[model samples]
Target: MIGLEGALYPWRFRLVLALLALMVGAIAWRMLDLQVLDHDFLKAHGDARSVRHIPIPAHRGLITDRNGEPLAVSTPVTTLWANGKELQAAREQWPTLAAALGQDPANFAARLEQNKEREFMYLVRGLTPEKGQSVLDLKVPGVYAIEEFRRFYPAGEVAAHVVGFTDIDDRGREGMELAYEDWLAGVPGKRQVLKDRRGKLIKDVQVAQNAKAGKALALSIDLRLQYLAHRELRNALLEHDAKAGSLVMVDVKTGEVLAMVNHPTYNPNNRRNLTPAAMRNRAMIDVFEPGSTIKPLSMAAALETGRWKPSDIVQVGNGTLQIGRYSIRDVSRTQGQALDLTGILINSSNVGMSKVAFDVGGAQLFEVFTKLGFGRDTGLGFPGERVGNLPNHRQWRQAETATLSYGYGLSVTAVQLAHAYAALGNGGAMTPLSMIRVDSKPGTMQVVSANVAKTLQGMLQEVTESPRGAVRARVPGYHVAGKSGTARKTSVGTKGYQANSYRSLFAGFAPAQDPRIALVVVIDEPGKGAYYGGLISAPVFSRVMAGSLRLMNIAPDNLPLPEQKLAAAGQGGRN
Candidate 1:
């Protein structure tokens, strides 16, 4: 054992071996003290002197249309930040940094003074890689570029209302962006890493927190249909010289918003001096009295009473019926002295509709309207959705009930109106609407009996094929069923309604027998010659629906047999 461990023949060799053993033992003891006994303290000391906890910016989610077309995206960008303390001492580097950042040197110095108490200050944000490299090439002290994300909108104004823009801090401000803020903006993480004297990344010690990228979101919007709706709505706005307008289309089967657009739209990318009124999603936020479009729903309500029939006669003597102070009248006697339920709608006779509502009473009408999702939000979860008002049954007077029958005395958002019509077209079942792509089929809620809604659907077709129908709304190869609305705008700051301002609207479903889609077209304050929904709104509806139906590959429901030449004459569209 002695020979294996050490040779002890010479005293010089023995002494050398003994000294070496003592030195090795001392070194091992010191290592044990540091590695086991005082490990936590030693590690903490080393980290305090040489380690940094750097934050990793979380990447935001991408937003794409249902068909995979990108509406909003986040591109990799570099954000230049500076250590205020280090920069304070690098006075000579200020000009080089300021010039690279496109800032006046004096202004940059003043900003540094303002942020002197802060450890970090942003020198530049959202810079291109090339630009960041140039700034770094100048070798400005205390300045570093961080890899971050900046949102980019490819569809621009076409989808501004749906995919709202984010702020400079990468937070959502409006539309879907605001609605899904947390889902799109993920949690940022931090890493414990070492850096050299020049602040260059060295070795990664450990991750304090793992960075999680935001999950991508897919919308229900069809970008192709959105473009079509936007183009048509814009053309109508310019042609009529209208103040504003909006258009919405829903897939009846899915209750998905295929297209939603508003005129006077602004680009989401460059939002300078953007007005709230202009930024508003009119289809979901703006509510207006629906005029005659309510006629179909009213008709459906009347039929639901079991006391009224579609063929029941409504006496129209001289086309006027006086209800105390209100005079419910048809424009002229052009409609027959007496007409059936279908005639009342085809003629848009206020007297006929008022009489029906009077017979049905206020409670029944309210029931049907509420079931159709009026007086409440559509639950689309869209930002700024307005729940329109519906007066309590006790508050509704006889005349008020009469006016409500013809789409007055209460207001409705365009999407609500469309959803109601879509309900009727979908066999009296209402599907919950959504802006996101739902994987499962949405459950349906029964709004009215299938027979009642179906009967109303058939009568609505007469509005486009009868002698007094809205011919412009007729598609070349599809059976269209729809109703027109022309309501006078209530005075903004006064009690009475406006004399000339009107909201023209058309709501309907195509292929009346087997509807696949429902559309709503509204033009606010149309002024060029014609203001009637039949003339202004229906034409836009026709153009948009034709393109949209074709884009969806829906088979045409009407053949080459030309429809009867019709015009909305003699019948009054006013409620």
Candidate 2:
């Protein structure tokens, strides 16, 4: 019995010792794997769990007008963020946070609990400083505030379309903001902070990066001119009972846009009910058939080719010329008989202009129009600028060619047409139109011969002086040369134009002898018993020109009336 007991005890002791050795080996292997092979993975997991990244928002830039009036500015705001796990643990205290944030406690609690696994989450974005301070005062676990910027437009609706606005992230989203986003949007930075086990920021660690503020942008637009144009455009819209209106004033020498005003403008500061149409910069985006305003270009092309003179007479047969299956007629059928080239433009004779365009051929017409910068971007740095549609010569039918000559079939933006007219005013030199005044030498391209331009200027002056012409566009005490255009709005897929619905346009440069400023005014479907450009748009042009000239202190060359001669009595008596 003593021998059996000894043997059993020895066997049990050996088995126990083997099991102990195996367990020790397994523990050693695990230590080796975790401490050596899986060291990096564990270290990363620990770092992710403890380290917090705080985004350092860069201060958004300011946008100023030419005279240094702030159009758009960035004001300080606060962004609320939280550690999801800590926020969920402090769910009972969320009501305090929610009340400070003006959010429902249940909803806020759900949001916090929903993303507990996430290391960080934005509780609220773009909070006012006061509200953010209130939230900070609550001292809720895991809740924190960071400095950010919110865009503010001081001029508000007055400069809405031009200055544009930014998104909640302080990113440029529209207008000049979108155009210069890269230069205006500075580099975003980050800040690292050390946190305790309770998810409280113990202390600020070393700053990982520093935020660089964006560069301020200065626009070429004048605030005074912009305000004046806005007031006038708004008044014109109401008075004429028009659907919409846009006016642009350009510096002839530099092509700098002085003012660009569109009716039905909205406040960029508070865009609660912003419409796509209200956001549109019609001066750059909307295109229309140019009607008689294009006659000067066509006639200039004809004159430039040495094919027609101002005195050249075309016998317009009862103000109608049949081209192919279509017949082009004058706006006024009552006017009859032969009309000279000057008379044709003065009378806005489509028949005579069509005959001249037919004589000039499409190739020459296309070349001239292309040189004037039609069917191409104007490089004005505006958003959504349409190049408009100018059909190629190959695509042009005989009738299309004739119709195009008198400003049909082809379309152009108001800015493009203004630039073209400005070229005419600037001694036949085309300057690059710019909305931002960059310090650089002005580049001028010779589009029309000086002689031809001078002659056309004379003819356009006559167009204003003639009885049936846009005489009302003439500013008193100043020589104003311009043309009025009334085009029927064309419907898509329809063969004909819409009656009673018209686009009225007046394009001119004041002090015609030596042009100073080139302006264009357009009214869409004026309801005040006048859809004619001479009646609607020309008057606005006149008022704006008069005001601009007076403001600029431009000396009137034709001012101071001459004394009436008594010889007129003798002349009348002799007759």
Candidate 3:
């Protein structure tokens, strides 16, 4: 202290200076390396820890019916997310935050503990805006709300099968929603931001990408008709005590589907109890034997060969048909002594149908069936749309061919039947069926000449007007034409058909001349006293088709109740 130079040791002083210089040099070299030599690599590593590339979710599109009623909509919603570490560090704020999120504080703490290693976690995936803001007002560190969309169906189960639905992540799962997913889902966007170690977004670094909202979709479905079909199908199922049911209606002019419904359908909005059984769209996915409904088409095919006439008579003695060892019988059939082509269709005689099918031959019958949209996808682009089984004509045995004529050897979906019958209404030209609204007209394929279609239309008219026709199928103020079918369902776990299990179906078009609408109704395994298609399915078709035709403002072709003494004036009683 008396003399600093005299007291200080030179060697120790030199050593200290050298140590300071070494430290300075080491720091300078590190700065140079970071600033120039390895600058990009270091910066990247730093950014990895402090910067986050966040997803900017693009909003989804809307779906509307042909009348512009919203069937599906994407509503804005907020999702609450959090950083596990930060949320855990602020234990004092846990109760407030958990309460705002409607979660128990103790359970939330346990969840935080379990996911401590994770940097990000979802607290609530979908929340209303009000609820989300309430959670953010708590000011809990590391908690954030991300904007997203929740798909909602306005028509509920009434349009469930046609409109389909989306999952919680806003992705299509079934029906038309899945069929046009690419067209409805828009491109997503992205952005970059700076975050602190605790995972709080400090500032926006840059906009990495821009977002694009999804395109709106317009369907060919008429929501009003859909509701009508849905309600009528449910009522029929309940009245008949049926196991299941399906219905389809199409615009004959454009082949646009107006309504498609299935019994036991689930509510798309409430997805809490979903099952494969309830979700199955029987109209487009399942197939069944069509019974006497095939009579008209068989006649059409025979007439195409120029060998059959509407006036040609067939002897349907005792109303029983025999082919090989298999015998086909009707349900208490009358007017069986002699039936012309029109009378055979009107009465739905199995024996008469067999006779006509034989005249057409197996190859011709197969061609007619294939041309009617059986055994192939209808090209509606719906997921799980079935191509109903139709064995090649080369495999047809005498019994098989006869049974096929009566709708036993082959099967057809409700939509397939609608497609075929709609073609008849559209001058024998089958147009491509569509679920979405089209800007251009759909193409058509001529399956039969217009002359044949006119002749067939007249014959079908007899089905509703003849003294021994399906009286229940007639709409009082309109000239309705359709055929009734009754068939036995195949037994479970067995190849043969069940005696008591029956499927009832009615298919045809209305305003008979200049037909505008065609529909098919199928009820499976009716447990009630009446299981025949005329008794079960025809009444439903009458109500729905009549209501629909009236709603569309179509001019009535038949006389009003007061003027028409038809019901009182010798109208045919149902068989």
Q: Write candidate 2's Cα lDDT for 1-575 as tens digits.
A: 86787687898768889999999999998888889977987877876777787778888778888878999888888898988977777877888888888889888778877889887899898889998888888878778777988998989888888877788778778889999999898888888876766677767877789989999988888888788888888888999899998898888888988888887789888788999889888888889999888999999899989978999999888987776589888888765698899988888999999888888988888998999999999987677889999888666577988988989889998889999999999988999998886467699999998889888888898888778788888888888888989888997688878878899999989788988788999888888787888888998898898888887787885664544345666678899
Cα lDDT for residue 109, candidate 2: 79
Preferred candidate (TM-score higher): 1 or 3 = 3
- Give the Cα lDDT of each candidate: 0.88, 0.86, 0.87
lDDT rank order = 1, 3, 2
- Note the clash tally of each candidate: 0, 0, 0
Put down candidate 3 lDDT per residue, 68-162, tens digits, no spaces: 99999988899998888777778898888778778898998899888877888999987989889988888887788898889989999888888
TM-score of each: 0.88, 0.86, 0.89
* lDDT for position 322 in model 3: 73
lDDT of 1 by residue, 267-372 (tens): 9878887888879899988989999999999999899989888789988899888877778877647887788999888888889999889889888889899999
How many residue pairs clash in model 1?
0
Model 1 lowest lDDT segment of ten: 562-571
- What TM-score should be assigned to candidate 1? 0.88
Candidate order (TM-score):
3, 1, 2
Candidate with maximal lDDT: 1
